[model samples]
Target: MKVKIYPIVRTAAVAVLLSGVSACSKMYDVKPQNVVEAKNTYQNIYDADAAVTGVYGKFLGLAGQYEVLNELRADLMDVTPNAGADLQQINTHNVLPGNAYADPTPFYSVILNCNDVMKNLTIMHNTQKLTDADYNQRWSDIGALRCWLYFQLGLQYGNIPYVTESFSDVNTVKDQSKYPRIALADLVKTLIAFMEALPYKDPYPAANSLITTIDTYPSKMFYVNKNCLLGDLYLWNNDYHKAAIAYKNVMETSTPNGPGDSYNYYNTYTLNSGSDNDAVTQSAWLTFFSRSMQDREYQTEWIWSMVFDKAFAPENPFINLFANSGGKYLVKPSQTAIDNWSAQRQTDGTPYDYRGINTTYKMVNGQPVIMKFLYNYVNASTGIPSDPLAKNGRWYIYRTPTLHLRFAEAANRDGQTKIAWALVNAGIKGAYDDTTIPDPTQRRITNLPFPYDFDARKLDAPTIRGKYHRNLGVRARVNVTNLDVSLQQNANFLAMEDNIINEDALELAYEGNRWQDLMRVALRRNDPSFLADKVYNKLLKDGNPAAATVRAKLMDPKNWFLPFN
Candidate 1:
């Protein structure tokens, strides 16, 4: 009764009246029909703005591939034998059948959206509603985005269709498309030009609206950003000098105060109780956390990320198909990885730096049962059993702790040997200094009181001998009570960059990145040990015994690059 006026009804009445007026207008009927009108059915700045928003919406389904692809390329998990799934099919060294044949479909989807945007832009420009400056700016932005997509496709698939303009018939383009592979060098140059021409000064806003409503999606994701793309391309080209410069540009411009306050790049560990312990305590500067298992939004650290919505989350067929709890698939870490961590350690007597150590070992019916990925534990006294092994809601993957050791390697690669050496020494010394010894002789201790040690030799050795024993017997009869002395000695021995890299290899073993790191070293120094030890051994274990007999056979150069499919 108080003269209520419903906004919805009032708006509908106005819309109907406007529609009637528009229907009778000959001028409106004479409007040119271009791609924007043909596709979006929207005209004028306001409607075109909505169209742009729809184009932006495509990004919501385009992130997360960077993490997945990077992790797969790293030495984390080998492709399981007879892996038939798409991820396995690609990872297992098979040649792609055609341009249409790509592992993750999102790659194609992104390209399609970019093409659509370009087509719509053409139509919108024809309408003459937008000024030359407005059209040029939007065109440049669209071109930049398309260039980025093409660059990614070229990097991943090598030979991919360079689709710039959009076609009216999607099926015709799809069927008649003869995708040509672009040269890496040429592709890099073109991408560089595209990125260089972009207006970095008047860049887009940040992606996170809650934190910064002014931020744009392109600015948040590395793939979309010019500086980030340049940095990544340079890194891929092995131009450390240029890569460092580009990365530094992003680092400096993105966060002027330094990585401490702004960069939330922390090592987040989720326990069996669903509690997370962020060890680094820094905001993530490189990656972000999102609710979706497959689609992750850009964190503060993310330079770029492919977005995925609930409807379009990518299915990693390799991880899903090959990773078996029992014996359904052959996906497993190589024995070399197992042996590498078995005897490794930090200078501080803490176990080696592996994230995914086999932790759940228990005696069952007087027999020791070795378990991996099992989280449930039984309290015999309280009769309370909790299954930690059960798959929780959070996405699971090996997360590497940001250590000074990696910085040392990066510095070394950048030819800052002095800084590299200094960082390595500090990291080693820091590890040694931070290590704590329990019982002063028999047991290894951590910040927590679980008596947990990942080093196999330390874990397996009987505590009755008054000290844990090394398998090598090099330091036999050494007083374990003097942990400081032992740690100091270890640090001294591992002070060199070479030794530190070895330690990194052994310590960070199956968590991944080993193969690529070794490859980088190989490229730099022509060291064959990476393949002799890490890559070849896996092949040898899988019935290629010739690979094991080092003198009997030589590895193919093709093995250096991962097979594309």
Candidate 2:
């Protein structure tokens, strides 16, 4: 029982002991064990700091399952022939209690870690070693993380036990009866309150210095920033206008040079000022996902990303399951994803969208495979790990483009079509028109143009909708005029909403948000037909009746939330 808590305690002890160890000494030589040592682990501010870091470690550990459960059920992925029964169950939307990916224990473990930190936070601060600013930052960090975990729990397994305290007795831990599951809506309200109390920025020390020397790659936005969770909560709550505001606040306050760094986005990634095939565009795209931020010194566009170390943390399983060198390679890109990127063309029709060339997927033995998370760790030509043991790369939770799209979605829902069009266009144009590119011709990716200035009287709404939806390949099988007519009526909003849904698929595929993206529209519009029309129609397009049955089961609102393990 205590062993479950030992990792957190030992990690803290290591952080404290390392302060006195010789610069050449390894910190892992001494490790703490047992309840007494765990009780005494955080006797100082440094120890408390380490415990807070442990919270992040726990969060990172959940990324693999988190992504799998979120993505596999969505349409972007297809279970490979090599995928095991567990993976198959996920792809079919038939998750069972024993499925490792569906287990809630890892997420609960993170909650417990946060509880442990909150319990001891005061003692560390009262000792005078911790400043008020640092204390507030840690408070926000712990609260936002808890809110995020709870939000995931609400989305995945609705009606989760809302535990906020640590239990020292192993025997007492078995008492689930004491902590009954709360409704998802009630839990979301609680999460909103918890997150709103947090400051938007950590605003202490230098910007890039928010992270420790040991974790040089993480953005402070990953921990201290709160708006990502706030925006997520608002979006889920159907507060579209508020969600737009929340996301806008984050974008405005965000530093382009990563969360705490001094540099802005343009400086951080340095838009490639070269030809479409130039090394600059290639490097910029690669560096955005790679560790060391392409040596830019900070994360510019990444809102929050997980950190990994070769010796301690688990490597990203997305890489492990997708990289050819990763052996298992259990998941494959759907034809939907392949077509989404490949179908794009420049105004002149020259296969103009190179964003897909090496950024998202690439041909391997004449089979198109996902390339986003694979490129940083594996060699493109050989399909082998650049380093057999390489364990680090950003696992994105939020980034600039997704936020842009979300804002666009919310704007469209609010009846601000011009705003929606402008946002969608800007997000795409921004990606292609990066001034950092030395050659303007090299920077272009899509033929789509920005929305004409907002004039309802002058707007060609149907054509604009068609262009945006067509560019992203999101329209349902229905005709454009039909979609446009549906767009005009509040009752037929799902047809219109498909535009954002498809855009999300096109722009944010395989990033672990697709299921929620599907659920969001489904839940908001109270339209289970979306589940049948978009998901099953495209995902089960191969004519599998069994898959069709699973889609029917999934359409039931109860199945929208995951089962408890």
Candidate 3:
């Protein structure tokens, strides 16, 4: 460098020196990737939040499908006689042993997803830099979700694989596959613990406020955060004392009216009224109306419904297949159910019977030919009719909302005989007295069409033929055209079990929990209803079309308890 001639050479030598830098030096000098950067590559707070959302998503997915399982258990719909050679495929009566492919399978799938979320939430708490409060809240949310999943599984399947933690490999599935049937008492205990640990207040109330309120008339009321679940857990456990307390909490804290307020009721028309298939309408009592048939969203009656959206809907094979007319499959209400509804009556004037109600017969030249699911469509914006016969009807196969039956049962169990008696009396009055015939005059003409003087041969036999011939004759004698009087004596013969069971069947018809109720009653008392004799004489009458087949089906002693695969 001292020599002016060497300046260029010095610069060149420095450049060559820089080019010869060691790999270790380069490594030491490089800055390590920070947590934020690593999180970008993996899951960060936002990603964790998304995961929690997914956990909730599974809840929604399962809600709608529950209705189907519940309905099947209730024996409201039998396997369609023409369900093809794959007769074992149908799940009704005691025919679900070899039919693990039935609706209950999805319920387990949901439980797995719930288990994953709960496990991941723990991981997120340990690995992520979430605030203590945030972590606790999220943890509580996951607990609540897990509680619900387990509760449903227990209710539907009795003893189920209780997966509380996440799996690292497929082999873990086998390890976690302990199907020890959790007793209802233990299930309730677990549910209570989870509910107690969860955050009762909504974290994001405004954004999720639609999840909070009844948007319309037949409001689908929901429990605030965990209130409904708590109540339901108690109800299922037959802890009516606790259930009443929980239900009372919801009554005091949430919705249109307080403790004494009437609960809102809804039907398919109100539930799926819009083009967007939005269930936020006033009529929704509780709903699971998401793209994912698995997730039951917009549950008005639900204390907390699993929230599914366009991003995820449950995969429902049967609802669309059976409920939709356009589809190849058709699962109609059993003739027994039809006859039950037609024959049932109420002590009061209201129709407690839902037979022949809301059923659709196949349409030939616009005339109903077969009583199938009533297909209707509504405008997306106004929630008004677009097409009366569009197959766009959304399906919600499960309903866990509280029913008048619950109250009736509570009164009966608690020895509130008068109250129970009144409830039963009212229900009986409602079933028969309530008819499609608008006026008393019309009802008289419809039930006993033949006038006192009308010729016997010309009269059409009553659609319902039973012990009521003399009653019909009496009405005809009195010229008792009053619809109110026509139903006065109908439900009088209904006993306590009959009232509760009938109410459960009517209110929760087509929902998936009936089998559990049937099982529970069977276990507690050797009631004729759940016994083989009952099944034979009542469910499978000798002259019934599928009597022999049904008898053959139940011959398997193991059919009583569902198979665990």
Candidate 4:
């Protein structure tokens, strides 16, 4: 649980972090370094240039923490015998204050680093060391990261100490009188306000962008997906209309080729004539988590990914947590998760979700292991990774499937249930041609009003085609059977919402999102059982000894979060 700092960090960024990652939450509240060091560090464009990248260095330390906190606590994963007490506590929902994984220190380390960079960047701008364009780009990029980290903190820890200033000393963070803890809702509103007010909402321009040498790993992969983060904030705030607009903006983002580029990934993989026949060849669905971010589809699909290379000194933390060999193998896919994936049929008339059976988790010597992190790392002939010393891969932050799922969630809550249901099982094209809605005009996707607007008016021309006409729904992409919307018999919003949540698990399990997905729905419904029941069921299915106690504790809602101190 004690993840190391990224060894591949920029020199200036490392200098910033030498001070600490324990800062106040507000921007410019305090200078992270003393006046002399601040003057020395923020003197020029080079120092200014390294500031944002430095925060990312600290950010990389959070690789496995996200997966451990998010999935292990949720219903999708279970701890193996090798799992330490910290992981065991997390699994059974009996985490104590001293639990290493429960410590909020690493998270604060990234936040403090963000605050450090933001504070210096502002000073450099005011002093004319950086131009308006340069300052705005760096400032907003770091700000978006801060917003995302804070939102995640709130999601995991609930009412947390929300500090925004740069803390010169680590002990300064304990002074709650100076920087008070706020409710998660308040934090959401604050983040929403902060992000919406930023001048630049898009990816950094060519000159200011964080460019990677490898083409498949796009510049976009290096930074936070600001719009997706905004969409999440709005969704959690229950402003589904605003959330839909935010998500729609991401879906409608133009290609790198000057806004006219045809491919702006909107769940656009085709359902071919041989779609159901994964019986003969490899599945494209599994490529979403491949070793290299090497393909064009990967370019659009990976909204945000934190990559690591052992040769470069940055390494994949999840390899130890999820892998069977050359790993601690502390975690495995839960029986409940396996059962859920097994219940669905792939397009090939197969009995399981292709992403589930062999792709996500596979048996090695008859033991089920999470293969997602180790898939391409392992050799075809042998079951172990090629370079076993230190692993290299990426941790998924947000992706296209998550984008569509979230978009569907927002649309559903905004009273667009049919659209939401379709997004789960079929594409928007299928949503439009819904069997229940007879009229073409009323059901047509092109005519849908603003907030629910996704233009599929022109299917022939690639430029004009819109919102999933080229796309299939989340489940449809994997060729699963259609989700039962119960549109005719019971047309329930919450039920359809439940369907979306269930789809979220089936599509996105072990990607560091399960707990948040389930928790968000449970909170919205004001029903603890919405989350507790599923968690209890997972424990029951796994035959956990503390199932009853865990269920009782989770029913209180307060017990859902970890001990942050």
TM-score of each: 0.53, 0.77, 0.58, 0.88
Error of 1 at 496 (Å): 8.3
Q: After aligning candidate 2 to the native by TM-score, how far in Å is the CA of 23 from where it should be?
A: 20
RMSD of 3: 17.9
Q: Write the per-residue lDDT of candidate 3 for residues 326-382, one digit (tens) a residue.
A: 343345455555555555543344443422343322222332222222222323222
Model 4, which residues run further than 4 Å from truth?
A: 1-36, 214-217, 255-261, 264-282, 347-349, 380-382, 434-444, 457-467, 488-490
Off by over 4 Å in 3: 1-49, 56-68, 81-106, 123-138, 155-157, 168-189, 196-204, 207-225, 256-319, 345-356, 359-403, 420-494, 526-528, 531-558
Clashes of each: 29, 12, 58, 9
Model 1 Cα lDDT, one tens digit per residue, 1-565: 0101111222232222122212212212343442123333434444433333333334333322433343333344445554345445333333345422244345554455456655665677787766555555555555666676665555454544455555433333234245454554577677776666654322343321211111122212322455545655565566766665664444334331123532222211100011121122111211122222221222322333332211222322222322233223334454444455545444457553322233212233332222221222223222123432322111222222112334444444655543334323332122322235444332321222111121211332444221111111111111011122332232433234454455555434333345445554554555556444554555555444434544122244334332334
lDDT computed for candidate 2 = 0.58
User: Which model scores highest in TM-score?
Assistant: 4
Global lDDT of model 4: 0.72
The alpha-carbon deviation from the true structure for residue 435 of candidate 2, after best TM-score superposition, in angstroms, is 23
